[model samples]
Target: MTDPAAAQAPTTVLGASTPRTPPARLGVAVVHDLVEAIVTGEVQPGAVLPPEGVLSQTFGVSRTVIRESVKRVEEKGLLTVAQGRGTSVNEASAWNVLDPVVLSALVEHDDSLGILDELAVVRGVLEGSMANAAAGRRTAERTAALQHALDHMHETIDDFDAYSQADVDFHFTVMEQSGTRLAPTITRILFDRARESSRFVGAPAAEALRLTLEEHQAVLDAIEAGDAAGAQRAMEHHIAEAWARRRLPTARD
Candidate 1:
């Protein structure tokens, strides 16, 4: 049986991955545009925003709209406003790492993929805990569901598109089995982010996919045997290796 300590892992996934766009709201549009600009490096940190009049005219909105929009990003620590200095972008160190807007902005608008390493680290931690939690509570049905995904992964190995899609489902199944309400949303976001940044892979054009399949099977074996720590460690090791392949490029994970 899995030890109770395995259940002690946190229920929440820390940090978030790639972003798409913010919702539609009064000031949200402004927030979206400004954040995109900053993240894309159109506006450097320490540089002042255009004058309110210029912004209002540029976005074709009233000054009040511009002010409100600017306020939202400021609240997220993406911008600083003052009596003399106007408003300026803050350093990356000052931004809120968890806000979806910030997260999306930081990741979505850039080709450089500045935050990939950080995203991988947090993803590793959350997925590790999720595997541990799932192991402690694995049911016959869940095991079969996992098995099904793995089988699909193996069968589709020669086809990158099919295999990559199955790999995503496999990960989603792992989080779903963890019995966490937030897992699906968080995992999907990460999956989307990974695709956005080209990190989600078929391990195409290389042997990367086959290696990941083996690592995933190790995770499944540990879970079936009710070894929570083993399951967690396996998942983390897979993520670390995956990261080495996705991020480093030159050195194999």
Candidate 2:
């Protein structure tokens, strides 16, 4: 028994609100719109999408473009196309959250900040393990490089942009020192995506830079001393606390 009011609720049409997407980028635009629609729950799980013809008219694209774009979205694990039935959205558990397009949409449209909070938890676990590994495998050269990165952060502490990059460099150094390829690669993807979202990089506390610097120092000291447990705890705490400081409050009713 679907509510009549809910059934009549307006669906968000990206093309209606935004400037026209360029002809050359129609496919990409369509895919982005579809992804955004699903991620924001404009189209809920199990809801069959409108026919290709309808979507074509809605997006001002040819039926072929709409078909292709739907396929692209399907490839990202957001849709299921079946014979004798229209294309339907899959559940969130079925989504390929690592896909850049999917991930970006998830972060950008996360009104409740739940996605970012989950991101922080996953990052804390992964980076904590990496930091533990780094402590066990630290070399003099690697330690020196990490020290230099921290020094650069100190030098650029007053410059937010520069300090941010230096902060990335320091983390990169630690990940590289850990000598595990896959974890670093995946962590980088997650970190990069989160950093790119303004919501995830929300207003920071006044002592943000100083506190961040101190946290980095603690991580470095633990790693340099080969204190694996200490390094792991320090790195986990830093990520968890950093996200807490920057996480924005969602608008309430």
- For model 1, residues 1-253, the per-residue Cα lDDT tens digits are 8678855643211111222233456467767778777766667889888788777666666789788888888988989999887998899889876677777766665444447766677778888889999999999999999999999999999888888889878888999898877755665676575575544342445488878999999999998889999999999999888877766342322
Worst 10 contiguous positions by lDDT, candidate 2: 14-23
lDDT for position 42 in model 2: 81
lDDT by residue for model 2 (1-253), tens: 9899977766476424333443578999899989998998888999999888778778888889889999999999999999889899999999999999999999888778888999999988988999999999988887899899999999998778888899899998888999899989888988898888888876665498789999999999999999999999999999999998887667741
Worst 10 residues of 1 by lDDT: 11-20
Q: What is the TM-score of each candidate against the true structure?
A: 0.74, 0.90
Q: Tell me, by TM-score, which candidate is best.
A: 2
- TM-score between model 1 and native: 0.74
